[model samples]
Target: TPTAVASTIKAKNYIKTITYDNSQEDFVEKWLDQVFSEALQIRSDNKFTDEVPQRYEVPIIGFDCLKSATTLIFMNLKSNKYEIIDRPGPRSCPIHIIVKSTENSIHLKFIDAKNYVSADMELDDFLRDIGKVEPCESLIKESWLLLSAIDNRIKDYTDYHIDLLQNASLAKLSCLKKYAYCYKNFNISSCYNPEDKANPFDLSMRYWKSKVNSYNEQDKRKKRRIDHNITYDDYQHFHDVFLTQRCHMCQARFTYNNKPTLDRIVNEKSHTKINVLPCCPYCNNLPMTISNQEVYDSLRNDMRNIKISDCAIRKPYLRIASQLNQKRRDVNAQHHYKWLTLQQIIQNMDYIHVTDDDTDSLCLAIAH
Candidate 1:
């Protein structure tokens, strides 16, 4: 270890860097080869370099090492551990972090062997300049999910270690739960880290997101399919029919993003003036075969009874709901038969016989 530390000085490293997270391993894995390429003779090696750059001629101050390197990595690195050499600090620091404190002075210690290399400062000048680091756990979780889904370990400090260092408080490494995840791998006795476990949250937020996305897509598609007679002004007029956007069938007040939608009084009919109501998506989604008048009558009666029922709102509300349920079924039966009649007329439109006068009137209307 001492010889390794001494070798860095022999290597003629120029600028040094100190980091607070696990970036050393990444630097060595990614950047080391590009710095010291082939044909460059290392100082420790006994063999002669074949293609030496023709700039310098000496062995220790030779063109071989000179061409290859101006800096070196002073890192003591191994599996899950990295330490900076000759730096005065605790070994446990992955990325060095020190919170600001009240006491005026700091014990300035940089080099262990040299006494004159360090000096104390009254202010934490470096921290004073660098502002607060932004924590982005959601972005981290997104990436982690992808890696976990593939059952892959994070390849570098940039992949996971930086996030861990930043979000030190909410570190839920190797999450066992579906809602949360984390990266910590050791001493995980009971909890399974969701970050480490890929398929735990169904391995597919995208699928569910797409499913939810279709709702909005369907609404847009519905608007496009509106009758040619129903212009933008007609839509504005329909919206003005309601004092507030409320569900016609269930009478649920439209709130949040539940969204106000248009419902046909009868599914067989188009969005004519008498055939549509402004309602909640919940009511529109329910394929009720009852007329809007029946729905309104049932809901209104239920509301009146609910308000004046002498009992507290909570206890007998279900009774009013129950009474309306029977009335709805009766109304639904009547509307269903009427809807079938309309369907038959629609189906027989091409086959139905017409008088010469009727045909002439239809042709003239089409021609005009």
Candidate 2:
């Protein structure tokens, strides 16, 4: 089905010219020239000069009458055509102008003039335009709910720093599992089992210390128990070991297929700190967090089951009087059914298996 088209109207004839009184004439001119220059520069770069003519003019006025005329010009042009010239106007004597494109030129005018007439008309037009736009009810509702949940989580973490730490650890573990594919060629068992270790890159101790200190300060403010020992280096170590080890979520020692996999948390000190959960290429182009793993797993399992069922029934079959059925027909039917059942059983078994490795394996891998 086609999606609903958004409501839109070209504000081509709403605002034309803006005139500033003598008091604001200088500032208005400066603002007008700057905005016009910027627009022209952008247009020139994009080769939009033909669509938007190059003959732009900045008109300056000193008297009230010129200001009134500028106001009138602004009132006639479209809202979209009129580029906001200056900062938002002040109450007593505001300073700001807007540019309105004209037939072969552009007109500059003040934002406020004698009558509240221009402002009110523009506002009315804006409101009417807004009414024309299509509303995505479902998207809006979903976004609001998601935002509310995030806000609540943030507040909870703020009140309890330990809550953030707990969430971070879980998130880091999930991240490691996602990128386990990268260790297919390597001895994953060694990586998963910290005792059977290999030397990997060192964790960023400085980065981890900063994160721990930040958390500590927050904990003090909240009067909560602080775990200052936990550092970014520790998280990095955990991530490095996970990737070096061939530790699938299932704890199976299968070789990886050389696909590009990302560690969940990127421990860059400049942009991010401690552990940053990376995105999953398979899941809606979104980064997978620890909290979202359960939801993702459930959905993935359901989809897999549905696909398996669909595949098994790809061909239509009818039960016949079996006592004298052809030997070939009986064998073929039995073979097909058995194969399907076996596939389903394997899938179910795979889904139930989970590795019991601790975070220490990941930490040790990176430490090496």
lDDT of 1: 0.28
Query: Per-residue error at 351 for model 2, in Å?
Result: 6.2
lDDT of 2 by residue, 183-254 (tens): 233342233322323343243555446655765565567565445334455666545643554322212121
TM-score on alpha carbons, each prediction: 0.19, 0.16
Model 2 misplaced stretches (Cα beyond 4 Å): 1-200, 203-205, 214-225, 228-368
For model 1, the superposed segments whose C-alpha errors exceed 4 Å read 1-229, 242-245, 290-368
Task: Tell me, by lDDT, which candidate is best.
Answer: 2
Instruction: Please write out the lDDT profile of model 1 over residues 1-30, one tens digit for every residue.
Output: 111110111123332221122333454423
Candidate 1: minimum summed lDDT over ten consecutive residues — where? Answer: 314-323
Worst 10 residues of 2 by lDDT: 1-10
